[model samples]
Every structure is written in C-alpha cells, then in structure tokens.
Target: MTVAIVGAGAAGAAIAYALRDADADVTVFEKSRGVCGRAATRRKEGCRYDYGANYVKDDDERVTRLLTEELDTNGLVEVEEPVWTFDSAGEISPGRDSDERKWTYEDGITQLAKRLFAATDATVQRETRVETVAREEGRWSLADAADTVLGSFDTVVLTPPAPQTAELLAAMAWDDDRRVAAHDAVAAVDYASVFTAVLHYPFTLDRSWYALIDTDGEHPVGWLAREELKPGHVPEGESLLVAQMGHDWSGDRIDDDRDQVLREAVGHVAELLDDDRFAAPDWTDRQGWRYALPDGGVTGDAHRSTEDAGLYFAGDWVAGEARVHAALRNGFAVGERIVEARNAKTY
Candidate 1:
C-alpha cells in the first residue's frame, strides 16, 4: 500500500512513524520549510525560543511513555516551574497546579516532530503544498499548486487545521456525500487568530513564574512568557519574551503593521510587569497565525464521513483541543485505523 500525508506536524508525523514498519510506502507533504506546525521554534544569533507552543504536557500515559521512554533522546527535559496567570487588571496569581509533567527538548519543540520523522521511513517533502486530491478506482491521487500530479496512493491523510482541510475538500471535484458532509462539519469548526511578538532584550529578566496567562478576557494581551526560563533559549545575560495578543485583539490587527503590534505588546507587558524598561527591546520578531487553533473539534459524524473515501483527518482540531499531546494521540489512533483498514483490504 502507498500512503500520502499532508501536513507533517505531530499528527502526520505520528501516523507516518506508526506505519514505518508496515508494508507501505509513505510520503509526507509540508508547505512549510520545517515540521511541527504550531509547535514551532525560531532561532537568531545563538538564541532559540519556542514562539508557538511553550511546551508539551504529558497527560496521557501513552504520550508520557513515548516522551519519557520511546523517544527519549538526548536533551529531553522537564520544566519545573509552574505556570502563573494574570488578570485583565494585570494582577498576577498562581494558575493551575496540576501535577502533570511538561516536556521539551534543548534544541526546540520542533525536535519532537523531527524525532518522530527520523524514526519513520516516510519521505518528508517540505515546501510542497498539496493543492488538490482526487479519487479514482479506489486509489487516491494528489496534485500540487500548479496542478502537477504528485502521486496516487492507497490512502491519504490530511492533518492541516479544520478550515484548511474543508477548503481543500470543497475545491476538489469529489461527488460523494461523505466529502460534502465532512467538508461542512470541518468548515463549521471556527478558529482563533493569534499574533505573537518575540522580544529580545540586552539584560536578563527576573520573574517569579515561567509564564503569565490572562485569566480574564478584558486585556489586549492573552499570554506572555519569558522564553529564557527554558534554559538555552536565550543567551546568558540576555532575555527573550514571547507575547501573544488576545483573540479579539489579534483578529482586529492581524493585518496591521508588525511595528504597531510589537508596540502594543510591549506596552501590555510593561504594564503587566510594572516595568517601564519593556518599552524598548534589543531586537524583535513577529508571526501571525490566522488559524492558530480551532475553537472545537469536528463531530464524530464528520470524522466518520471522511473515512468513507479513504480519507482521514488528524490534528489537535480532531482532539477538540489545541495541544501537542492531543494531536499526537489523535495521530496514533488514526494511524492504527489506517493500518487496520489496509489489513482488511489484504484479506
């Protein structure tokens, strides 16, 4: 069997790794240059920081074992600091006191997907965007932006966000009710926009907690985390802060100038920490996620509907939460389902 996966994030990588030992030829397509979609990391001038997801929390035993035992390569470490929350009024307080363990790699969170991909035989084709998919005689065919044929596969899994998946399906000329139903259900899954500003300072910042979250939605800032807390993320004697604007604020100025967004983020962090020095930074970087995360996952009906056409959906969106662990879990489950389906065909 031949398999083609779109989006080489956690979910897609998990699926490919699970099928590595199987009698299948797997290929993964990722539009971006790197993997681990939102659980992204950026580096500059000997400094690295996770500007997307801060870290991965091990809530599921399987995920725990995967990180702790299976993929326990070098540099896997736990974050000891607790997460604290701040209100719209800028009052900082203790947040969730869960005993769950948070895990990250010294290189970056993108190492997770990189490790998974390395453990698999799947060919990861980065900077390749799968534009269309077609089904013919029980086999699946895919194309790129210029309508060039990629390949025909026994199965194809899509791991992009719900909205993107829906758009792709809708644009395709599939006449099955399953495709329509799946597209509609996935289209219904709304997403929250997020604007992130990465600020680098000349001096190290002193903070009681690793990160500060806004408990109340009355503030322009949604989250602020000192990336230097993760050790190795910042150069010694320097600091890096990742500030994310609230959904409302992000949606409003998602297309605004990067300078304006950085200015607002600096002001919010300055007020929150009561430090006037935040007004200036040694350097800055920015990224805007239009579909940062889905508000909710697709319904069971929507999931099953896509399966009718040798199509599978996997992502944090399918797990109803925008977390790395959830996406991995979903990916594992979807991979198992594909393996079973392939075996059934053989019989």
Candidate 2:
C-alpha cells in the first residue's frame, strides 16, 4: 500500500512512525519547509523560541506510554515542573510554584517528527503548497499551484485543521454528507486565535514555572513560561513568554499590525504580572495560531476517523483535542486502523 499523508505535524508524523515498519510505502508531504506544523520553532538574531506547542505533555496514559518508550531511544527527559492557569480577570494561579513541570526533549519538540520522518521514504516537502487533491483513475492526484502534478498515491491521510481541510476537500469536489460533516466539524471545533510574543530577557521570571493569570484583566495569556525550562528550545538563563491573548482581541489585530500587537502585548503582560520595571528585550519575535484549542476538545463525533481506509483525517481536534497527548493517540489509532484495512484488503 502506498499512503500519502498531508500536513506533517504530530498527527502525520505519528502515523508515519507507526507505519514505517510496515511493508507499505509511505510518503509524508508537508507544505512548510520544516515539520512540526503547530509545534514549530523559530530563531532570530541570537534568540530561539518555540512558536507553536511550547511543550509536549503526557496527559493521557497511552500518550505517556508511547512517549516514554520513545524517550528511552530518543533524548527526552522528565522535568517535574508545574504549569499555571489564569483568566482574563488578572487573577493568578501560580503553577509549579513549589515544583517543576513534566517535559521532554533535548532539542525542540519538532525533533520528534524529524526522528519519525528520517527512517522511511516518507519525505517531507517543504515550501510546497498543495493546490488540490483530485481523484484520478484508481490512484490520487496531488497538484501544486501551477496545476502541475506532484505525485500519485493509493491513499491520502490528511491532518490539517478543520477549516483548511474543508477548503481542500471542497476544491477536490469530494462532497459526501460525511465529508461535508467533517468540514462542518471544523467550524464546530470552536477555537480562538493566539498571539505569542517571544522575547529573551537577561533575568528569570517571577515564577520558574510560567503563571496563568486571572483578575478582571483584559489580557488573558492562557499561560506564561520561563522558556529556559523547555529543553533544547531556549537558552539556559534567558526568559521567554508566550501570551495566549483573547480570541476576539487577537483575531482583529494580528492581521493588521504585528509590531503594534507586540508592543501592546508586552505592555499588557507587564500589568498582569504586576511589574512596572518590565521592559522589552533587545530581541523579540511574534507568532499567531488561529485554531489554538476548542471549547469541548476532540471526541469521536467531533473528529473524523476511518480505520486504515482511504481519505482519512486526524489532528489535535480529534478525540480529546488541543492536547499533545490526544493528538498522538489519534495518530496511533488512525495508523492501526489503516494497517488493519490494508491487511484485510490483502486477505
């Protein structure tokens, strides 16, 4: 079986990793230059920051087991650090104030996908934007912007967020009630936009573990982190903060003036943290995530799933969505379903 996976993030990588040992031929296609999709990282000047998922968690049992096994072979460590949760009220919930949080990786979280992608013929196409996926003959057609053909494969496993997936599927004219339902699920997969400001500070923060604030504050940065603790991602002593701004605020602003967004973010964060002397760092960068998390997360109905079948889909939005662990489990389950379907077809 030759399988083509779209959107090479946690979902894509995990499926590839699970199927790499199989006899089937797998090709992982990524539109971006590097894998990691939302779990992405960026480097500028002399500072490094995690622009996407700042951390990989073992929140679920299966995810814990999978990561634990992978950690044995890969260079992942366990940090007992705690993470704080805050609200728009400017009130504070000091996380890991007494201890550290659980974390892994010697490099950035993207390393996990890189490791998975390295073993098989599943090459990731960076800087390659997928124009459309049209069914041609018995196989599938993947096209680029010029309407040129990229490749033909027996199956396609897509892992893009709901909205993007819907657009792609609609372009293919692959309209089934189920398919349309999958597209609708993306809209129902309620999420908010986020603006993350990554700055390198000379000193550490008030909390070693980032704080989640809530106190009638307009700025609700989901949570704050020291950045130093997120192994292999940031420097040893420098400070980095990613503020998950309110969706309404982030949506209206990020598309217009990014620098203005940054300045305003820094100023708002300073107020929430109760620090007047807080000044912007010499080096600063920003990132925006539109489909950050949903209100109810992924469930069987909320996320699309097909066992080892054609035209499958999975992401953080499936079965316990938004969490790193849930995403991993979705990948594992989808891969198994695919493998099973292939076996059945062979028999």
Measured by TM-score, the strongest candidate is 1
Question: Local distance difference test, per candidate?
Answer: 0.86, 0.69
Cα deviation of 91, candidate 1, in Å: 0.9
Q: RMSDs, each prediction?
A: 1.3, 3.0
User: lDDT tens string, model 1, 176-270?
Assistant: 88888888888889999999989889998877787778888768889888888775677789888898889999989888887888788888878
**What is the model-wide C-alpha lDDT for candidate 2?**
0.69
Against the true structure, candidate 1 reaches a TM-score of 0.97
Which pairs clash in the backbone of model 1?
none
Superposed on all Cα atoms, model 2 deviates from the true structure by an RMSD in Å of 3.0
In lDDT terms, how accurate is model 1? 0.86
For model 1 the local lDDT of residue 27 reads 95
Worst window of 10 by summed lDDT in candidate 2: 300-309
